[model samples]
Target chain A: MTKVALTPLAQSLPASVPFVGPEAQERAQGFPFKARLGANESTFGPSPKAIAAMQKAASEVWMYGDPESHDLRQALAAHHQIAPENIMIGEGIDTLLGVLVRLYVTAGDAVVTSAGAYPTFNYHVAGFGGTLHTVPYKNDHEDPDALIAKAREVGAKLIYIANPDNPMGTWHNAARMQQMIDAVPAGCLLVLDEAYIELAPEGTAPAINTSADNVIRMRTFSKAHGMAGARVGYAIGAPDIIQGFNKVRNHFGMSRISQAGALAALRDDGWLGHIREEVSKSRERIIQIAAENGLQTLPSATNFVAIDCGRNGDFASRVLANLITAGVFVRMPFVAPQNRCIRISCGTAAQMDIFAAALPGALQAAHDNLG
Target chain B: MTKVALTPLAQSLPASVPFVGPEAQERAQGFPFKARLGANESTFGPSPKAIAAMQKAASEVWMYGDPESHDLRQALAAHHQIAPENIMIGEGIDTLLGVLVRLYVTAGDAVVTSAGAYPTFNYHVAGFGGTLHTVPYKNDHEDPDALIAKAREVGAKLIYIANPDNPMGTWHNAARMQQMIDAVPAGCLLVLDEAYIELAPEGTAPAINTSADNVIRMRTFSKAHGMAGARVGYAIGAPDIIQGFNKVRNHFGMSRISQAGALAALRDDGWLGHIREEVSKSRERIIQIAAENGLQTLPSATNFVAIDCGRNGDFASRVLANLITAGVFVRMPFVAPQNRCIRISCGTAAQMDIFAAALPGALQAAHDNLG
Candidate 1:
């Protein structure tokens, strides 16, 4: 066999994906999961107006999407009350995060994040050859103070925090978040991943600071807007920081149908309000079921709940396995303590009922096998 | 303004986009272009089945796309008579090219291409800190012998050639392509961009050699399938080369709707046949219109034609500017000789009529302004 030369940095990396998508799991198991509650997706779906817009634009796929994503960016700027120069649109938060790392991270540079906050972010840092310095979660939430201190100590170029975070579904209020933003060191860039911010309570998302050169807040249509598959996300930052993305981003990456769909979705404030109400109700139901089953539930500002398995990581893994076997898809954190809980996304009542039915048997199966 | 720290390479790079999209032009002009023929897009549109599939998936955009793009890859694998492991799908050929460059080109690595080839590819190489070595085109076509010679001379890690080349729209037969592939330096990778392969003649595509580790072939649904906005593209290469993409690619970058739509488009051979016929007809019409205006066209294997305006680079640029002013969108090459020709994409008869009506005026305007 012939050997093609690869970059030394690329060769040193492992061929691993950040997360095994639920679809891959289904293919391996030879059947699909009955209730898709693991990925923190909005089962309520995108607004009908967005769907209509995308379907209408389907026939016009012959043309390339505007590389600038002009109209969509303009609309986003108006909605946020900022100049379009302060926003940069991309395929998704994941894609934007990858671009962000490329702009700031060089080999051997340091980056700080919660130990298990978002594996995808860490994956990007590692992919760019950045050395990761992790701070453990404090009270099941990302420790902003620790992350800031560690970044300063290591002379890290980047720090990542997900407001209304994933896995544990815990969040800090706006004032606390503002403090963290202010405490970000001089040379380090704070990446505020607010993918779930739309679902968080009032006073959760800090005021948009377009002039803040040290912070870039990323928001997406995937969570509360219910268009994860559409792959639309934007970053709000200082003009210079936003313009830097132009040097590295795939300019024509946006899907034309997605641009149309996201624009329509963003304009429909009523649809967003409705999704919030539906997600709130679903969260309450999740709390009720976990309480009824003698499990403790974490408070959530996002569209998912983490149910305490009341045991070690091993017990939780066994329970998750049984749940998968029972056709319910739920995920857990990768670290200790947090791994003792299973995270479930808010779904329709029917889907939740399926999870509700499967959990008891799954728990029993876990106990019977382990004990 | 506070200076956020960027990597040294990034700091040294200018904030620039490879191409300014047509929408930006429209925004500046304060009106839409009457004839959209600049980007070489398939004005014939996507398969009806593809449009339908995307329409159906519009409602399902709440869920994230299968990060693996599993079903589409499986379908592509079957179509090409190759294992799924030999294929890697991405947002578009542009994204795949970016990843390929990241894998092969580290800082200061030598990469070779024709002087006026795809600018987007060059943009990616520069973005990754690759030192590009250019060889000028021979007789308005990509010179395989010259490219191979330059690669050897520079100890190039990667060589790029677009078969049925863009900007010029000329191609080489499969046997010549095979010679080029066989001549690639031992450690260097040959990147064959066949984004227009479906529209090329039957003998144009070289036989697939998945075991050949030195070459990676890229294709897109953008042209003949008419789904440029959907951003679906794939690369066929050796398993190890394909696997290397996993180390750095955004695994979940694909839009779920695009995956579904592309799979449907690939399965509908009759639709592809129809598109090819339409594109062929449109190409003939474009040739006729150029001839009526007393211009000479280069032999074109792709959907677009390059018309030599019987003048130098300055005159061709003036003609293009006049065309834009007359509500027609067209493009021209960037180098000296190639810049004497203007590139125009095929469009429907009504759009062609508009272009036809405007071409005489544009030419007169160019002559009047220059004389």
Candidate 2:
């Protein structure tokens, strides 16, 4: 354009975009989906108390939130029974992941993640020029043992493993997860993403530890707490490692009303538990609906259930298109084999009813269109 | 410590931080400052209508926002009369600034700025491993010609200039600024931070350029539109360069409520015009108050006025301390010559009354303590 050039790194980076939004697809399709089950959002919505708190705080949008996010951090500390230094709040786990990667991984440094794990984390690694070594999923689950071995092999400075893993919604028990955690090489900091732990059964999450310097566990209000739109998430870790974020994070990046809403959300664990139950029922309904359509369903511990479509990724994609064209918005895995199953988020009884009603017709259409 | 070292770039970054927020100081001081004007927040707050929109969107918090932020960008395009492709929105101008710097700067690359310009910009340069070359402000104004020369001297990749500049609040006319813009070296990009532009006078801003590949003009609703807490800002540049942000930005970083408030704030230009009027009156009041206290006040097109404290940096620090002790919170420039002044934000008449009541006594106490 102007003959100005960007850095070599930036130039090398393809104007590659992260995940393309459902909205973009919807606009291209020229229609709105009757049911939105994509993006793994909590269709059940955030806690009523959080909604009320945001409503209450709506009028005070002029004042900046505490730069330290002091009150919210205090509330989180009390909720987690940890010291304030054990917590660091931010825009979301996605944003925090970027900061942590930037903190530890330099150009040419190695980092590890399960193949087909959260691409956002990978995007950050690529953004900072880190070398990423991805391990394949074992038996449809993220193999933490393989991840640690690869980390040691690669001499990775960081390794990311999401418990109750995305795409598949499969998980390891807390004891086994901790076993993997304990076996990680001393020099590689483990980033255990517990983003879906709240929806999983008890023992699906490892015990909290703020003194562990070699690991940082991330949680989000976006999932079980159901405030995805609010963009609030936190990382819990050793104080020094946690404080490392202060060196480079946009210090005043949080929204004031979000801090207020998160505080209210954390205090309403009763609501969290209730939504967890609803998600469990929704999962069951989704499984039943899949079986009714003669599709196999995976055992899931997360909010979304992956339905095996008895076909390859291309076939699953065609089915997904059929679903979208039928006014039901759902997504599927990106990699092979796993992409053979379409991932559908747990939705309200009515939204699921719409999906349940439409899936049969969509499947028939896909079958009819098959050449 | 686990001794899992940070990257060389991250390790090289200082443990330094941005402005110690007023809330942090208030906590240290054991009482909130009576007049909260240090950060240039709109005391009048965002429009009532905007708050209502955020409240309306509160329960929808469980849904992730449209990642494209299409509605806001479309509205912004219509409002600014530019193609939607020319605008890119992010968490805030601060976040966008970091991303923009990262886009062009690699390790050891040279970036130029005034010695005492925005510290956060400097923070990003250091964070990205860019070497910072500083040119001292000439006559309390950011010397664009000097910056251009430095760019040519060091083969600088990027330069920072804030029209209606921060700290000292001095500005160059649009014609002078355009001349300086024309002189930016062919390889370098100029970052024009207009964070406080809406409150600025008519001639203080440059005409919007849809084809400016060498410069990215930043504008935000943080100052006059009174959405500082909401954390929304956008950059206007050539389409190709604006889309370059796709490679690395946190695609879903913006909060939904924030989008609502910013959209509403943008829709209500009357509220912004009202804010400008109020800011002007407050500026006049600050000037009169400074004269009453026997100090010189500089002309300001932005929301804040820089008052010459009639002494050096040390004396001004003492005066600022006296004001803090007298229960009024104010800040000053951190570096020499400019630090010989105190910067106060435009607040309500009543807040200025509080400031006026405390200034003479604070000045006297500072003088008495000099012995």
Candidate 3:
């Protein structure tokens, strides 16, 4: 084999995917997983209005999605009581993060994030050849203050925090989050990822403001809105910061029909309310189930329960494997201490019943495997 | 206002959007246009099977799309008679192009392309801080030899060539493309954007070779299969090259419903055949209309026509503006020689009739405006 002369940066990077999707696991196992709670997707469907809109526009799929995603953005602005100028929509918050990294962090630029936080953001940072500075979690929650300190120390261009974070379902109250925002270095942009905010406690979200160019709030319809399959998300910030995305973002990356569906989804708050109620109940049920199994579950403000598996990371690994073998797909934090737990997404009652029935057997199997 | 500092390269870039979508125009005009032919979308619609698949998957919009996009890739590989490893599915060709630019081209890296080939690609290169090495089109066709020579001279890292290309709808046959591919430098990756291949004349596409590491072919369901609104596209390349996309791609970027819709569209070739036939007829109608109007229409292999207004770009601009005012949404090429022509997409016979009715009035309106 001949050595192909790839770019120096490309050659330096390892071919790595952050998560092996459940679909890949199923393919390797040669069978489908019975339940999908790994990706923190909503089990409840998108709003009925969304479905109707998509169906109605299905035949019109030949046309490109409105590049501006005009209607959807208008609806989002109205929903949040913010100006449309402050909103920038993308394929997902994941794509938005990548674009922001490209905009602010070039090769070897210092960027800061929480350790054991969203690996996808870290992946984007690494992808852009940015020097990543990580601040570890404090008591299973992201230490936003430490993140700000790290960013300030490194003279970082970007500092990131997820308010209602994934993998742990722990969040900081907006008031607490604001202190960290105030501490962000003058030159750095604070990327406040609120992907799961809609399902989080009421105080978890900050008030939408157009005054600050250094802070951006990320939101998604994948959580309480139950449209993860639609691959839609947006960023809200000062008009200047929001407009900055236009320089590098894929203008036609959106699906026109999906935009229509999202607009329809946004218009129906009743459906969002119903799903939110269902999610809260599911979270309570999961906590109860974890307690019944003699496991401690973290206090969650989002839609998932992070159950402490009781032991080391090794023990939690066994539990996750056993659950996966049982066709139950769940995930966990990748860092130590937090890795002593497994995270389960809130799902339908029927799905939870399957979980309730399987937990005891899986726990025993995990113990046996560890031994 | 306190200045938020971005990277040096970012500060240098103007926050420019490549294209303003028709929807944006609609909002500016305070009403919707009568016909939607501006973006070169298939107005004929997608396969019934695709519509049905998307509708059926509407309830399952809670699940994120399969990150691997396995089933769709497998089906596409089968359709192309290539191995599954040859494919990398993405949000759309636009998104993939952005990633490709970032992966291969560095700051100040020379990347060669047509001066007016695809502004979206140019936008990506500029975003990545690459110095675009542009060659003007020769007689409305992308000059392969000139592009290759420039790439060799500049030590270009990437080269973009869209065959059966956009805007102008001109093409070089498979033989010509093969010659160009062989001439491509060893280190340079020829991005063969065969987006319009499905609608092109037979023998227009070069035979596929999954092992061709030097070239990557991009295809989309947007043009012929008519699923542009779903926002699914894929690249076919050697295994090693395809795997490189994994290091940075948004793994779950694909919309699950889009995968289903595109897969269904791929399987229904009969619908594609019908669309191709209709497109052929529409192209002929545009040519006839152009002849009647005393204008010259370029020969096209794709679903659009570039009509030479037999005058300067200013006259063509006036004509385009007049056409827009007549409620016929059409676009012209941005580059000078090409801008002497106004490009029109193949719409339904009804839409063509609208264009037909409007063209004479639009030309007169241009004269009136000039007066």
Candidate 4:
């Protein structure tokens, strides 16, 4: 049997998933995770109104989703005070990132991001055969100055920064973010990922400037909106950049039920406010729990907290492994120095109770194993 | 005022949607279509079981879908009597098509398809800058032999053919398909799109041979299963070819609710059987309606029927325009000769009654406008 030919780029790429999902780990361990917090998904769940909307739309799945996502985009435009042309809805922020990378990065073009930013973004760059340049995090935060300088030096086509960072949960205030946006070089696009913005404090995000030529901000329903499995996200950008996505995206990719759900979720500010308050409470609980356990918790503006293990990466990994074995699913940063901490997503009071009960025994197990 | 840099390929492409969805047309017309029979979606909708599953899953949408699509793939593998490795699920057949083209066809590479088969597939090819070669349909059917010959002649890396072809619902028997599969060039891959196969008769589909390196078969929940808005589709091929999708696909792209809906739909073969029977009845009714109106209907194994307008492309266009004005949404073929026909999807009896009532006026309007 002769083999079919693959493109040189495809042949050169490794077949891999950026992150192994918690479900896969559960399947391997032959048990379900008691608390599903490893992936930074909200345990608070989607708004009750969104759930009702999806349930109502479930019987109408015969019709294809509106390829333009017209209703959803119109509502989003109104929400952000921008023209509908400035928004593009897709399967998720991950899908949007993939399309954005394909639009801007050709083979051998330089792309810049923090050393340990979102892995899915890095995966897309590599898939498109773009050369990636990385700058290290400064004080556990994405260093915008270093990133901007690297992009200019390398003539990078795109630079990525998560406003309220993932894995580390650190954030930059609006003023600092506005300066970063201003510093973007003429030819470089800045991908401002604000997936966690809804959970952050007030003024965490810079004001929306839909006409800004070099900056595209991404937000999602997967965070405080509590619909990660709904797979709905949108990018806010200049009309030209937003329209560019149409040239390559799967036009009918959104689920009709997801559209209805997200619209409802967006409209119910009361539900969103409740979720924010709950998440904030959970965050404080996580911080207090860490302190009680003799660990240092990083200052966080996002839904999750990163607690310093006060040792090296290995110790953090050991602690995480022990936690998982003890029926608590948690994750950690991968890069050195930063990897001295393990990340834990905020969950319900009961889930936090479980985590609080498990951490001391897991730490003891790690210490005993090391000895 | 400086612009962000776009890749040369991006700069060269037009920012356009492949298909203007029926909903957009409705929005433009300032009213909903009285009958949405265009787009070939199942007006019958998904199974009740599937709807229930999706509604149930909606409350649990805070978690990301299993990136591996483990449970659904296992169910699909069991249903098809194949290994899980032979299957790769995606957002839809459209997304799978895009990924397949990216895997096999690079910029400037040759890809083959019927001239007016599936425009979305062609759109993806163009999006990736692949040089497309087209063969005319033989007697309104996708000619497999012609497609094979063109692939060999062009040294094409990929060839696409839809069985029980769209636009003109004509199909070839399994033996003919097997012969065509055998003719695939050694280095070329045959992307056999079997999206409509479930609506076709027995012996219409070529037997699955997952070990066959040159052919990959795609199936979807969008058509006969009536889950188009759910955006679930899968491809069955050699394990190696299936695995290659992981190198470039959006791994976490599938909506958790959609996965649940599709799984439930797949398990309810009884509902599928019921749909097939209903569609068969709808097809007969469509044929009778065409016969009463002095039109000839083509033989169709799929859910939709193509009725000959007994005139040229212009007359057919006028007929379709009148139908839309009469609030009956029907579509037609795009290429010459075949453009002499108008396509109508299988609808419920009430919708069929509306279409039957509207056809005579539409025909008269076309004739009166001609003078």
- Candidate 4 regions exceeding 4 Å error are none
Position A54, candidate 4: lDDT: 96
lDDT score, residue A29, model 2?
92
Taking the tens digit of each residue's C-alpha lDDT, what string does model 4 give over A1-371?
46778889999999998878898999999998888779999999999999999999999999998889999999999998999999999988999999999999989999999998899999999999999999999999999999999999999989999989998999999999999999999888999999999888899999999789989999999999999999999999999999999889998769999999999999999999998899889999999999999999998988899999999999999999999998899999999899999999999999999999999998898899898
Winner by DockQ between candidate 4 and candidate 2: 4
Error of 1 at A275 (Å): 0.9
True contacts kept of each: 0.85, 0.72, 0.75, 0.88
Full-model lDDT, candidate 4 = 0.93
lDDT of 2 by residue, B143-192 (tens): 99999999999988899999989988888888888888888898888999
RMSD, each candidate, Å?
1.0, 1.4, 1.7, 0.8
| TM-score between model 3 and native | 0.97
Candidate 1 clash pair list: none
Q: What's the CA error at residue A212 for candidate 2, in Å?
A: 1.5
- Tens digits of per-residue lDDT, candidate 1, B1-371, equal 24568899998888998888898899899888999999999888899999999999999999999988989999999999999999999999999999999999989999999999999899999999999999999999999999999999998999999999999999999999999999999889999999999999999999999789889999999988899999999999999999999999997768999999999999999999998888888889988999999999998889899999989999999999999988899999999789999999988888899999999998998999886
**Candidate 3 error regions (>4 Å):** A1-5, B1-3, B368-371
Candidate 4 lDDT, tens digit per residue, B1-371?
46877888888888887788899999899888999899889999899999999999999999998889999999999998999999999999999999999998888999999998899999999988899999998889999889999988998889999998998999999999999999999899999999999999999998899799999999999999999999999999999999999999998868999999999999999999999999999999999999999999999989899999999999999999999988999999999999999999999999999999999999999999999
How large an RMSD does model 3 have? 1.7
Cα lDDT over the full model 3 = 0.87
Clashing pairs in 4: none
Q: Pick the candidate with the highest DockQ.
A: 4
Model 2 chain B lDDT-worst window of ten: B1-10
Chain A TM-scores, all candidates?
0.99, 0.97, 0.97, 0.99
Interface RMSD of each: 1.3, 1.8, 2.0, 1.0
